[model samples]
Target: MYFLSKELYFPPVDEASFEGVLAIGGDLSIDRLLLAYRNGIFPWFDEDDPILWWSPPERMVVVPSIYKVSKSMRNLLNQNKFSVTFNQNFREVILGCQQIERPGQNGTWLSDDFVASYTKLHEMGIAKSVEVWQNDELVGGLYGIDLGHIFCGESMFSKVPNASKIAFVTLIKYLKEHNYKLLDCQVHNDHLEKLGAIEISRETFMKVLKSEEINFSSSIQQHGR
Candidate 1:
């Protein structure tokens, strides 16, 4: 592990050391944040902990077009009971995700600092959100960074059953409509796998990220209009 300083260039973190944590305790400046994402790294730490950057050895991702929609999920989609929208109430989406508790997580990782940093990114048009609604009520949604042809999904939460799924499906539909090629889910778990997320090598993931130059401004314009 290394102490990242404002002047020190980030080291080339080896995949083997990701388990040990490559860097710890750094301010979430725009430069640092952008550099991390560009290198396929991200910050994930609790409020009580210092900033911990991670780049897991095996990257989990999903190809937008091939996401698995189970029979039940398909039925729910067909029913159209829930309404979906984009970039609507982004703060609300982040707050909703923070309030919900995941099965294994001790508590919310979306701390105040995390929210503030990502909110700044959102303002810069690099981070975006997808929202799901039920009769004027906010039920579920997700937020992530747009890196070129890739959408690096961060977090999502559901107030009602299938709400998150709806948000995810809607976002992917929009991605496909706009010609996105990949949706990076970040890490693997049963939930993501069921939704068609698969594991890829970190090298491959970085290679793809390096090859693309995303224009988030255009996507934001298209989405808002």
Candidate 2:
């Protein structure tokens, strides 16, 4: 595996290991983070390990036009039991993601430094959150890096049944309406697969990531407008 230094550089994704670990030991500076995401790379490591960058051979992505919502989810949306908002409370959304326990994970990868760094990204308007509120309480939410046309989702948490799903569906609808190219879930999971996310070769994903057709102006419309 390659090791990163002070230089804001990363090895090509094609050079990654079989497990997709591209490089290790890079600071999550704003510039580095931005550069990483723009190139279809992301950092994921446990709290005790050095920052590890990855560019998987296959990317799990949801094309906005093709995202699927189940009949049950459609009924839930029709009921309007939850309200969704964007960028209203990013810190809390990320904190929720950090604290929520997952089935196979021993602990979260979202350490304090990771939280603070991504929070700074949110302040700078590059990171965004989708909050699901029920009776005005923060029941569920998700957060990710928004790179104009592609949304690189990091994590999500749900305090109640289906809350995170609601947040996700709402975000997909918004993206579809606004013409987003892809929702980069980054990796495959059964949950995402159920919601129409599919695996594509890194080459296919990189094409969309590096596409010049993206309308940067589309990113300016924020807060669920």
In candidate 1, stretches whose alpha carbon ends up further than 4 angstroms from where it belongs are 15-20, 212-225
TM-score on alpha carbons, each prediction: 0.88, 0.92
Candidate with best lDDT: 2
lDDT of 1 by residue, 129-201 (tens): 9999999999999999998688989999999888999888778878777777678887778898778667766
How high is the lDDT of residue 136 in model 2?
98
lDDT of each: 0.79, 0.88
Residue pairs with colliding backbones in model 2 are none
Per-prediction tally of clashes: 1, 0
Candidate 2 per-residue lDDT over residues 87-127, each given as its tens digit: 99999999999999888889899999899999999999999
Candidate 1, residue 56: the lDDT equals: 80
Relative to the unseen true structure, what is the C-alpha lDDT of residue 4 in candidate 2, on a scale of 0 to 100?
90
Residue 193, candidate 1: alpha-carbon lDDT: 79
Candidate 2: regions farther than 4 A off: 212-225
Candidate 1 — what's its lDDT? 0.79
- Itemize residue pairs with steric clashes in candidate 1: 148-214
For model 1, the run of ten residues with the poorest summed lDDT = 216-225
